[model samples]
Target: MKLSLFLVSTAGLWVAANANSVNNKQTKNDVCTHPFVDINGRCLFVNNFAQMDWDAARAFCAGFQGDLVTLDEANLLADIVDFIYKEGLTDRSYWIGGSAGAQTGAFVWPDGSLVRMGTPCWGVLDNIQRPGAEPNEKCIALNKDNFFFFDNFNCEGEISVICEYKFQRENRWAEGGCATMKSSAVFVFLAAALLGSDGATEAGSHVKTDVCTHPFVDINGRCLFVNNFAQMDWDAARDFCAGFQGDLVTLDEANLLADIVEFISKEGLTERSYWIGGSDRALEGEWTWTDGSSVRMGTPTWGANGQNQQPTGGSEENCVGLDNANFFFFNDFPCVTAMSLICELKL
Candidate 1:
């Protein structure tokens, strides 16, 4: 009955561009890691069974390596509403990412991007926002009773969290729309051709044969091994790579970074986030690889959550990993979090 009611209110939904609304239709980029579902190119984790206050909800989502879902686009909001109704979820208030805590009346996502205001985004009654006080409140959510439009509620109010994982596809091929959803095999081939990769080696090729024979399938390129089977914390993951005469993977060339990401995404190895070799443990913000080389920061290298930059976690997240949410772009994660890893050693 909820979705049925929402379908008739479609005219109220308008399109606004944001990280999660890049695609018009529902298409999955990578397989949603268990407990998440593909919704219009976003891997969403919906927990209607648990309820927590605004702050607690944020911490809960972070445990899953995601932030609260931001519904910047009208269509995405509509899709989520329909999804809840169809999935037989209870018609109750849900927590979203926007917050006015920093500055009252101005809502922003976790990455500090201003939450789009007005319109089909907010519920209106007689052409006026249902609750005039909502805009000045601290946290934002989809008011289920208000036809699922953005509404501000007190931060302490208990509610279910709907988080969105920020998955990015920043490969150079995207300039021509290559990132657009397509068959896995076709996309992989196109990416390989454009980036000069052959998918030549499998994950199991970490064994050595001769002086010229190495575990990786390469001639002179980086000897890298993707560990898709085991998951471990940052230190343990690094030790595993050490046993193979390698450390966590590090990137110095932009093109090589692109190739590795494409290989992982296309080859279906995105089920979990990966531990790379960059960490700021010695000095906060001084990111360096295991060999003590500096790690690159900023666009095309570090991924973003909406408008929020990567490595924004500050002191809490000292280790860097290729986040699945950012399409393998570098993301700062807590060292304690368990994940798969990439091992690299020069041949």
Candidate 2:
């Protein structure tokens, strides 16, 4: 019997809950680095934090000595989605390696494998031409806006990235021999490679940058921003942050609660509530951050409700916010309630 792992020549694919838990059928020995987890024989990095354009996304992956992930394997999509959801990328799309810009109508991966297009692979659309027929939407993406299935997206659209690394580097990259790029992205990747030849910036830049940019305040060691001006509902607040490649703030750090509260208080902003990205909308009372991390409850985190406790509103208050009524500690509130927001930029 020929040895194979995760390479399925079939149309049907299953959605897995964890990348490592998938039935990827192969002998294992390859160990991936931090952030890149081993799935079958492949090392995959699901970059849910930083959002970049398709070309920039590929370049970012190249920084890690990898390339934008290729979904040639049937079970890989399932595994990738499993990792994405686990990372709390339920609201973001992702740029992959496949593009039809090379052949116009034909889509292929960096490895020259034909980009699969079908029901379980591509999301439902009027005309499913795999890499899509739209001239503008040449880059392939697992679009979160369109049910996390393959969708041809605009090359310039900024979204998340799924980087793939291999022990045998010959499987990917433009220099591997065959011409795989869609068009200008090929040159972009080469330029980035040439620029990185001197090794000034390491591949670790994929996760988090050292310094926070404008609008994002550097608090102690973290990057955060308080939108004390615009009042929006919980959903709208999150979407607003998404535009900035960020999301609603999560008081994850020990000193974040005290520092941020004090900062906003000095701005005279704590007098009004601010959305802070904790919600039990998926499951009532099970509060979690957008990335699926459990929100640390009680103690100095959540506020009190009279003689009871905060989060007293139950399902009606699925969304969480920093309430001034409770001295700016955490409090559950209706998701529709308009409140100014606190954003955390991952980029």
RMSD per model, one decimal: 18.8, 22.3
Candidate 1: tens digits of C-alpha lDDT, residues 1-347: 11112111222321112223224444345555535555656667667767899999999878767788766544456466666666666467889888874645567767665665543355443435433564335888777655555677888999887876655211212211112222231221111211222233333332222221233332124556677889999999989977766678776444445556656765788788889889999999999987787885553356543345578999999999887754566789999999999887432
Best by TM-score: 2
The lDDT of each candidate is 0.61, 0.62
Candidate 1 CA-lDDT value: 0.61
Candidate 2: regions farther than 4 A off: 1-19, 24-29, 126-131, 168-347
Each candidate structure's TM-score, on Cα atoms with residue i matched to residue i, is 0.41, 0.42
Which candidate number has the best lDDT? Answer: 2
Error of 2 at 329 (Å): 47
Expressed as tens digits, the lDDT of each residue in 193-265 for candidate 2 is 1111211222222113344555665453455667888999999999998876678876654235655665675
Pairs that collide in candidate 1 are 166-325, 167-325, 168-326
